[model samples]
Target: MTLLAIPAPAGWDLDLAHDYDDDLPPAGAEAPEQDVVAPDPAGLAAVGLDERTALLDAYVRGELGRVLHVAPGSIDVAGRTMNSLGVGSINGLELQARMEAALGIDVDLQRLLRANSAAELIDCLAGQLGPEDSPHKSAARRSTGTPAAAA
Candidate 1:
């Protein structure tokens, strides 16, 4: 949840269509568009042992969306690569910290870095919470289950 909503500086138009001098696409060429999906608070808040994996997926996408300044639902949580999502080392680190804090578990940053896609990253993080890891289980005590192993 957002703790603060910082307002943009007044009178400063930062949109690409307004203040930027970006090279426009060739005349008659249509710009590729991505569908932006609205945030789903209910989905984000979903809980339970059965829902644990889904919860982690939602959290990962939500954190990714926050980092990229996009809608969480717009993310292909199960497919898109972190590189395509614009998650470089800096933001990837931030995403790691956010997940650690939000999911109440210890995450391996190196493993996180090795993740090719958001789906893999979610699986890596959730897999660390398997029943064998009692310490992690207590940290993520809200529920217990081996989160689905994503492909």
Candidate 2:
């Protein structure tokens, strides 16, 4: 076999990989127009646990969006399963790391991977955010857009 000599310099295309070959829209179809909704910083300023948990929910959605490389509004996270959303071990780790650092909590990577839906994952992280905040309470607040019934 003959060896090829290297040139003095090589050109590289070091751009963020935007060529989503598997994700191309069908011909004669227009991509949906939507904007990723971001959480309000003011929500984080609230002293109540529900408000903070809700903020965490929104933040998890944004971070999950970044990991999945899709708009947060593009998916009904509450309705869709994580497997359908293409979440896997590696991306789960990526999402977990971002949430952990941003929320200042420890989330088991397995806890995240085992979640069946986006809301489930949100609940896990929200639970970690506070000792008294149960995952069910977080899920209820997220799903109904209202506080859980007080005991």
Candidate 3:
């Protein structure tokens, strides 16, 4: 399988798309049963940095859509900033509160203000949940004087 690397903001970059082999099985070939495991919501907090980033991205997109009264899929969250969505300070606070509640994490209001785009916001949240040795967490700790909790 070949993986596709879609360019995204730092920490948000992922290679989820794959190209499967074109070769087909011969006629009448039997296929084996495959077990598919669903993601567990309860285990989200234990997930690694990459998974947390993805979850945060989805959360931001959904919340933005709900608050903006637009379809989640219709919003180009990665490319657009909250300000571009016509969100003011009050709306930004509302969005931040909603995200904190949904993710069960405390995020700094100043960090939210500094984030210029959805991708930037994702990076910020990911840093809080990233590994202990991550530079993102180090930077955040320096700025906030508090280490971020694990996801």
TM-score for each predicted model, relative to the true structure: 0.52, 0.53, 0.55
Of candidate 2, the 10-residue stretch with the lowest lDDT total is: 142-151
**Runs with alpha carbons beyond 4 Å of true place in candidate 2:** 1-46, 131-151
In candidate 1, what are the lDDT values of residues 1-151, reduced to their tens digit? 7699667799976565663335866678764533334223233334433465676676677777787767788888666677777887888788777665555455556656656788877655554544543333323322444342221
Those runs of model 3 whose alpha carbons end farther than 4 Å from true positions after fitting are: 1-42, 131-135, 138-151
Best by TM-score: 3
Candidate numbers sorted by TM-score from highest down:
3, 2, 1
Candidate No. with top lDDT: 3
Q: Which ranges of candidate 1 are over 4 A from the true structure?
A: 1-50, 132-151
Superior by TM-score: candidate 2 or candidate 3: 3
Per-residue lDDT of model 3, residues 27-91, tens digit only: 67754332223233335436787887787777677776666656667877666666776666876
lDDT at 35, model 3? 26
**In order, what lDDT does every prediction score?**
0.59, 0.59, 0.62
Using alpha carbons, what is the TM-score of model 1?
0.52
